[model samples]
Target: MSHVTSPTGLRYHLTHTPPHLTAHSHATLTLTVHNPTPHSIPLPGLTLALPDTPTGTATPHTPGPLTLQPPQGWTTHADSPTHHTLTPPATRDSQPHELPPAGHLTFTLTNYPTSEPGTSTLHLTETPHPGQKGTDNAEPLPLTLTTWPSGTIVNPPTLNKNRYNNGDTATIEWEYSPADGIDYTLTYYPQPAGSGNEKNTVTYAQIQDHSGTAMSNGLRHAVYNTTVPLTTDPVPFILTATYQNDTRTYTTIASVGEPDAQFGKLQVTGHTTLLSTTPQTLTANGSFTSPTEGFLVCWTAPGTAPNKLTVNTNGESRTLSYSICSGSLTLPLAAQSAVSYTADGVSGDQYSVTWIPLGHAINQ
Candidate 1:
């Protein structure tokens, strides 16, 4: 059947028209919901389930677990060991927005059927999608899945990290069936407007294949990447497996970010008076750190080339030394730029530096 229509006049469409997959084979499936009714309708909630220890084919693969990687932008929840409910992201109004009379939405997911080989019937039930802050457990439509027997199935790659900072290291693991020969390639697109885009192919001779476990189809290989640094946000990576002039690509996404350093209190621990050729010091209320190659530079005097005080706050608290023209230095309110630290090694604007004088006004 091309699609299934519910009593509510909502149409459900699954990839492969008839909604079928091969046993022990990995495939990316897409589910689309169409609103064909005269009036607007809510998005149909979807709950996908995988059959455990399926039985149909003669040569069943070793019993293993199933893993599902959902598409981006869907909020997923595991209500049971093998059942997951997929919800759409909330709108700005936090209201249950209705889909236009002729609107539609599509979601994709990658399925890893590594368990016993059999023509197991998969269930993808359609129900009422959850709203702002509630659970939805209503279903009037259901999409059916059928599995066929297969021995040589293409597998998708798995990433070690799901979310990480930009400069973190990650690895990709996948398997390939033994054919005339197999080739592999890795393509990645970093965030921040796709700064780095590159691809590399690994020939069969360069592969260090290992024995397959019960959960894999054929030989397995792992690629360690120390330079999987992301630039801005979550980035998707692709790994292509080519064999017998056919190619299949698998994708995995990883989120990257670095927490911003907060501004802390700095107190002048040394005497209030300072000499032109002498040095001054300040201590932090707590441990200070500069993730980047940045340091704090306090504006000691008001003149051209505002005496750049050298202050290094890497691990422990440090001090600042400057050549101020001996004058009574009164630290103003912290709201002003009395002292600041650089975040990107360029501008000291990320954090505000506050200084609490010891006894009296500081003089240099």
Candidate 2:
């Protein structure tokens, strides 16, 4: 038995000639290879290898080197039992023919056994023309063969909507039979437009019993909450669900057009008209009126401790203390009253008081 490997290149396709072949039956193996690079390359030779099964040994009958004519201009030669070579035909100019870029080559193995129900492999080795160098001398291209399956597999989850608006909740629903020891993981990738970065958020859940049956009509569901910050452009939400060796992906879009209107109403508030010189005395019990809702009293004082503000309202005096930093203090006024605010050692300080009416708290 041989270990089968996958093919590496822009695109490669391998299939059994008769779609389905029973064990010990003979079938043709076809391979199509696409050239992805810009420069023309020397085509590679392919070697087919099959697995040894209890029934019989899966063998490939090798064919002679292939010669292709103009418009194709390529020639293939079997260098050995397990090696083949592809090169441009010799020309009057004596130049080596090369496979055109983006072109494709199809090769077939006439009769190969299915021998066993498992995997078959095809190994491709490049036999360079006279003086070709670099990647042309790279490793062999390995491709695994796909066998017809015995039964049908369940399809991946499907979404009801492909697009959503900002703050929209998306639901992903899927149905599958429960298997012991099998768990599922769902991951969401939020890619903001023009951000050039993908953010991964993952959620894990165990497949639960639906109506006490391994397979049921009721499907499991998950929700993607998009209440947080979103991008300005359409955000792509990619969700991938995985269970053991099988995995599936679903994608949805969240379009965030013009900015949220509520975000624009946020701003700093206060009066800038009052300016006082340092050490200037405020008339004792002087009164300042604020908006009906309230206002934020902000001031800058020297970075020193014991900054004091005394507020006298209705003959009751209270002193508010401030620490070493300069910041703001909220003054909520419910009703009109003769309120006096006096600052000690904060005279001539640059201060601005912004009004914030009731019900205007940004977070609310």
Candidate 3:
């Protein structure tokens, strides 16, 4: 229930316009055959071929000689308007022979130089002269041919490492937008150094603050405030984007605090007498190691200077100072009376201190 024919014939404007053909190699089709009953439409003898599919087919060879035109007094003749097999349509008394009421018809399909551009379906017929009436005759249409191929496209760039700790903050983000001219580079590597490579490469327009929207879920943010140190180190993360011409590299994997706890080591060991006599009892043993294997301890003094250092450590006190210096420690131990220290738990240094002596200051 719809009708509007004005493809302006020429085979419906060359089977639907758009440079139907160009150059020494033709491919044109404009066939608009519509006689909606009012009478006058007869032109038969059609043949367009193709049939041999067992999962292998490539056919195209029909050039030099193919002409069918009608747009004036309407008088055409064609027992062989030339057709040399473009393959596909296989059937119709073996096919060939088409001429109608001369209402409309335009054809100039050629191809010969070994063609592979595909799409086939063209066969029209309408023949009934001689007290004619075989359904009025003229109906069988199909024409399509388009070829354009050659390509390569790869676009992948993203990274956003938001939340961070152990030194306050950090943020690093990224993204990409480059058209064909091809030549890119953006890189990063370092985080508990697990090693994935590409530790450096930058030039996707030189990305630092990367203010050009790159956090499309590939998250990479950097906002470090500073000073979050006491022990434990290992903030070795990575983010990469590469194409320094070609080998392609896009990666993002992070790690902070696990590579032996980043970087730290402070050790100043045991017993700080500094000269003790009456009521003598001063000791100072220390240890603090990092690299993931943590440990801690501390002790300071100078006659009633026990500020807060009493973690005698397990195993009582054999004058102390054995495993108390495990991973890291900062020593400034001055003494004369009571002093003790402990911290040999390990793992980024846990922390411990002890100091006591109230009766050894020249009996003041």
Candidate 4:
């Protein structure tokens, strides 16, 4: 029979189909024991013996124990004293009989035989027959049993993080390969830095779009985050992913204990003051150059500004005013350039013209 070896070790499959067997008759299955490992092994022949005296004592000597080389799980159990009697027939209460100067003999396994899939161990000890000096018996040997390996086996997943900006949006993805019989659950925890007295918590969620790729075997997905704004402090994070119904296994794919990737700056910059000017009236409010998407622009005014005037807002404005009152004001260069002359001759309320550049010039 052929078999596939697992990288985790300790398993051998019997590939061939079983043959039809007659009732009460033994069936011998032909199988090829192949060791997935690259190394080879050598095993010893089994031997069994009995003691002549009721009390047995064998001279101290190391009889070679059974050896099972790679790709082999076959052991021999001869009908010798050690193999046959673990507990002597209680009725007789009689210990086995043996001869002095007893030497070792080899026995090949028959009856319950075959190189089947299983685990095995052997015990090689010495004992001297009671009242019989120099006469010793072999110690009892061990038994072996074979079975299939089962339960979920999981390999660690790799996480990939891309560059993102402050206030911008980015996603974290993970990939994992699971065994044929296993299922998994992945949880993601994103904690921003400086979540203390200086900063507020940012609420985020793990989004699972119907048309998205999953970290595990497409079994499940989810999102989590706070409602406050995210910060730049070293925020700790954790992810707990598990195989379905696996209460006996655990592994860390990523953790707060290890080095983590930081979030992007999410920079935002635009006019913050509302323009109650004379022309090109507009209203706009939203994130500025967010990482996930771009900015948004909206305008609403009773009548368009007199000239091609620029519009700006502080995100929330519901009223507009245009009354000439002596006061200090701030304006963008684009707005100032669109205007002609202001009453330059005025005392008590003097004019202070400020210039702001709206276009970038390449270096020479």
lDDT of each: 0.50, 0.46, 0.34, 0.28
Report the C-alpha lDDT of model 4 over 43-149, residue by residue, as the tens digit.
12223332221111223212223222221233333354334211211223444322122221222222222221123232322233354322234333322222112
Candidate 3 local lDDT, 201-312, one digit each (tens): 4454554345544344443332222222212243333333322112334444433432223337855598333211232222334432121111223433323212233343
Candidate 2: misplaced stretches above 4 Å? 1-46, 50-104, 108-120, 125-141, 145-165, 176-185, 189-198, 203-214, 217-235, 241-248, 254-259, 263-364
Provide TM-scores for the models.
0.32, 0.37, 0.18, 0.21
**Better-scoring candidate (lDDT), 3 or 4:** 3
Q: Model 2, range 103-185, lDDT digits (tens) per residue?
A: 87666666665543444456655544455563345565566543332322223545445654444444544544333322444
Query: Which sections of candidate 1 miss by over 4 Å?
Result: 16-20, 53-73, 114-119, 126-140, 151-364
Question: How do these models rank on TM-score, best leading?
Answer: 2, 1, 4, 3
Candidate 1: 10-residue stretch with minimal lDDT: 326-335
TM-score of 4: 0.21
Candidate 2 lDDT at 273 equals 26
Candidate 1 residue-wise lDDT, 1-364, digit = tens:
2357765566777664223455556665566778887788765456776555455445544323434444455678877766679776667887554568888877655544444333344466655554522225444354544444344434677777778765565666666554433456656665455354333344444444332334444555455453545555666667676533235567777677764344599678774432122223344222233322222334333343433333333233334433333122333222222343322222333223334433333332
TM-score-wise, the better of 1 and 3 is 1
Q: Which stretches of candidate 4 lie over 4 Å from their true place?
A: 1-162, 166-169, 177-181, 192-364
Better of 2 and 4 by TM-score: 2
Error of 1 at 56 (Å): 4.7
